[model samples]
Target: MTTPSTLPAAPGPTPAPAPAAVPAPLPRRRRRAPKAPSALLSRAGVTALLALATLYTLLPLTWLLLSSTKSRADLFGTNGFAPGREMHLAENLEQLITADGGVYLRWILNTVAYAGVGALLAAVFGVAAGYAFDKLAFPGKERLFSLVLLGVMVPGTALAIPLFLLAAEAGLVNTFWSVFLPGLVFPFGVYLARVFSASHVPDEVLEAARMDGASEFRAFRTIAFPMLAPGFVTIFLFQFTQIWNSFFLPLVMLSDQDLYPVNLGLYVWYSSALSQGHPEDYLLAVVGSLVAVAPLIAVFLMLQRFWKSGMTAGAVK
Candidate 1:
């Protein structure tokens, strides 16, 4: 009977293969621990400090704007932050342009020439010198660079007297060339260009161009120059700002009011206002100060993207 039962069991459905075991999900990586409260507080503190710094920097600019709106009498009579009884900005500007046979306009044009031309020349020379320093192998390269670093550390103001003397010796004093020539020698710009070239310009690319029979000058002009555009722009802007705001150098070099930059002209007006007791000159100075800053603001607004890109260009690659 048992044998008969065993025989009957043979027809039963075969057991399904045991389902393949699923891999237990990999242990989930432990999530990063939440930042400590102290760390969060530090970040908040840093953000607050930055905000305060920005406010401090902007405070004077705010005062300038408010002061520009006031008449000469209101400028001193009222709170520095308060608006005047009447906005004299338009009238002040009209006086600014028309005063002294439109000498202010001439000063603006002179400033453009000095800053624009000087910055352009500085960019060219700086880029070329930097490229040579970076790519070329020669004796005394490091020493020359060190000398440049020394020059950078030396304030341009400190050299103003010597530069003036040199200009005098060269018979360039009291001329546009005196102010312009000095601005063209931007050691810091060369340093910056060298730093930029070392990173942005690859040796391999230059070698490849050389292999293609492109002369070094041609390669630099067509290839390297475009790659170094950001650096060039940075150098140009720096030199432009320096030349534009330059007071002592131009003051020492230029005797002609026609050759005076806006900064120098403004200074003359401010001095005359203070010394000659002309209250109207004070209003003109304030308005002129506002006008003088506009170009710089416009320049920054226009080139801000380029400036940012240039600053961060080599940071990643």
Candidate 2:
């Protein structure tokens, strides 16, 4: 009976455990100040550089435009940007056309033939070579491609002599074939074509074509060539411009004025002008150059869409 009445322990105040130390918030990393001034300065510098580059490219053309309108006296006397007292562009063009028994027209025709035909063949040949290189498994493929790369690195100037010799051996020197033949072999076009073929021509599509009983050439012609049309335009434009501007090769290859490209023809006339100090000759060259550049501008404007597509071909979707 005595053990049945146990009392509970009395409640007592107890000290609170010392507060756990709060970690000091890490010092906020000081945000770097914006380099607004330096950034502005860098942007300004780049903008200025590009502006200068544009000005540099356009300045000559502007001068050519202005000078072509000037009379011989005005060309030397007027401010380069200023229009002349009278427009002589018509007079200059007439003179250019009639000069030296109308040899300038002959040169223009020759240039068209060389650049136009050569570029077409070059594009096809390069694209085919590149397609074969990328798609076909053949012995000496890499080795042959290496040679093409080596050819690319070697400047046309370096090859002029060797080519001249080869043409001489073949009795093609001083003929249209001399300049036209060399322009057809475009190493850079081949390289670009390989890249384009690798990017644009899917292996799956080619395999599917094979499965459908299409021969390799038929697949290439029907399926691949259409895909590579932009690339063809690109290569054609490049080689066409190259052959159009080609001077040294033509100068070395051709002794006959009849076979001279427009560029070479101009060189001959310009040299004659310098030797004789003929203002009329100088005026003729200016007009001729202006005329010559028009075709290039037209071609580029017409084909810019294809060129842009070709350039951005390998971009991810």
**Index of the highest-lDDT prediction:** 2
Error of 2 at 315 (Å): 3.9
Determine which window of 10 residues in candidate 2 has minimal summed lDDT.
Answer: 34-43
Model 1, span 1-317: residue lDDT tens: 35544444447688899999998898889899987677436988889888999999989888889998888889989999999999988887788899999999999999989988889999999999999899888999999999999999999899999998898899998888998888889999989999989988999999999999999899899988898998998898898899889999888888899989999999988898889988788778878888888888888788788878988876786
lDDT of 2 by residue, 69-101 (tens): 888899888899999999888887888789989
Give the TM-score of each candidate: 0.85, 0.89
The positional error of residue 83 in candidate 1, measured at the CA in angstroms, is 0.9
True lDDT of residue 314, candidate 2: 69
Local error of candidate 2 at residue 79 (angstroms):
2.2
The runs of at least 3 residues in candidate 2 whose Cα sits more than 4 Å from the true structure, single-residue gaps closed, are 1-29, 37-45, 314-316
